[model samples]
Target: MPLPTGSSQPVYYVGWDVGGWNCDANPASRDALVVLDDALNLVGTPWRGNLRTTLNEARDSRDLIDRLLGLCRHQAQGAEHVVMAIDTPLALPRALLALARGDAVSALGRSQENPYLYRETERWLFQRGITPLSPIKDMIGSQATKGMHLLARFAPHIAACGQWLSDDRTLTVVEGYPSPAKRSPAFAALRQRVNMPATLETMLHQPTPKQQDIQDAWLCALLAWSLRHAAQSVAWPPDSMPAEEGWIFVPVDSLTPPV
Candidate 1:
């Protein structure tokens, strides 16, 4: 289970298992993060805590950026790209975004578009027999609220960065989903045998992966690694995937469900 580093540029992947708006996330609460270097090895150290604790508050967004930049600094001269794969909806559906932005009544009309309530990428995953909760519905649960706030605060920074593994860029963020794959029967079998970090693997075997946020963060990093080095992924609606809505990277084959 060695990680790859064939690419010339140094890219670090970070995984964030987001918490809620009530300030109720921590290592014990299934919200955590992990960092992996270009060679897929741990960088500095993986951490777990409440997003509210790190992020502080909406106006305190700089705290989050400062922390991330510090992580990027772990590499030399900030030449590395930090591809953050966050296990939360990095962006909301267009209608919702509109509603959030004060187009309250206008968004109701477009509701007919994604009448099924799922985002485009979400629908695409469903077509492939993968199921993910609707960001709309999940938003009500507070996790989406926490993530959306960060996206707004960090959008400018992310926008200014490069696409993919750009050397000039210090950060590139993407959406990530680990639940569908983890819930699959195939992954269940591998829980007994797969060779990942011992602590993470053991967490996967728990009755409820409720406290496996750290492990999920590690998987997020692995997904980013596979996408960068191997390019083994499944992106739906190839012709047009909206940047505003965000895309989830699910690595093909073994990464999808442990073998």
Candidate 2:
């Protein structure tokens, strides 16, 4: 029997949340890739693979670039536009990078400088009506610092992609995270304050199968689609003013505050 061909979609976006190690250390360190359709539905099961060891060891940025391009080729097979949101830092805005290099009380207060930089960046985004996709953490939680580090690296990557897609406005890469923390009320409140959408389960209670990183990648893809379609503001240089802005895709339904 012949199988029916699926209908074509206007665009496809893929997001990858690169991790130091796999879900279980026994599995080995592998990058997690998630593919999403234009409708923001999970189009395919996530795939896991080794990080480009050659690039990591050789310090060859090209290897990473090549690997990402190849992933695009595979996931974007027939799509007109493809956006890839990576979970690593791509390029930092000149201003923020400068701040990181500077010595300020707030910046120097942290154990690591990266968190300070991210904290500043988040403030910058929020002021501009742009909500950053970052994990929320409690004041005393150990994970807060880790979440800040993730943003410090990932934000720049998303910005770089924004620069690349400035021309066509078709391809957008963003940073994101899942909402409604299972164990962190402080975190959940923060996401809500930012107007980030949470599922009913997330709003009412935390759900299991908690792969927050994977969910973040999926969110990034959704944001990319929104940017391409003018659902979200697209800011580049020259034509649009260059500001330290982080992109997030809030579901239309989620944009409104909860009653």
Candidate with maximal lDDT: 1
Candidate models: Cα lDDT each: 0.56, 0.40
Off by over 4 Å in 2: 1-10, 21-30, 39-41, 53-80, 87-96, 99-116, 119-121, 125-163, 166-171, 180-210, 229-259
User: Could you give me the TM-score of model 1 versus the true structure?
Assistant: 0.68
lDDT of 2 by residue, 14-120 (tens): 66655543233424334556665555555545555544442244222223333444553343342344565554433333444555788444433432224434443
Q: TM-scores for all candidates?
A: 0.68, 0.46
The weakest ten consecutive residues by lDDT in model 2 span 136-145
Candidate 1 structure quality by residue, lDDT tens digits, 1-259: 1122454556667788777655453334545777776665666555655666555542433335447545434434434546777777655566566666766443333332352366667656655666667766544347766766666555444342112222233456667777654654443443343344666555645624555776687667665655565463423235476655666666444233311
Q: Candidate 2: RMSD over Cα atoms?
A: 10.4
In Å, residue 137's CA in model 1 sits off its true spot by 1.9
Estimate the lDDT of model 2.
0.40
Q: Candidate 1: which stretches are off by over 4 Å? A: 1-9, 25-30, 56-66, 69-79, 97-116, 139-141, 157-168, 183-210, 234-237, 254-259
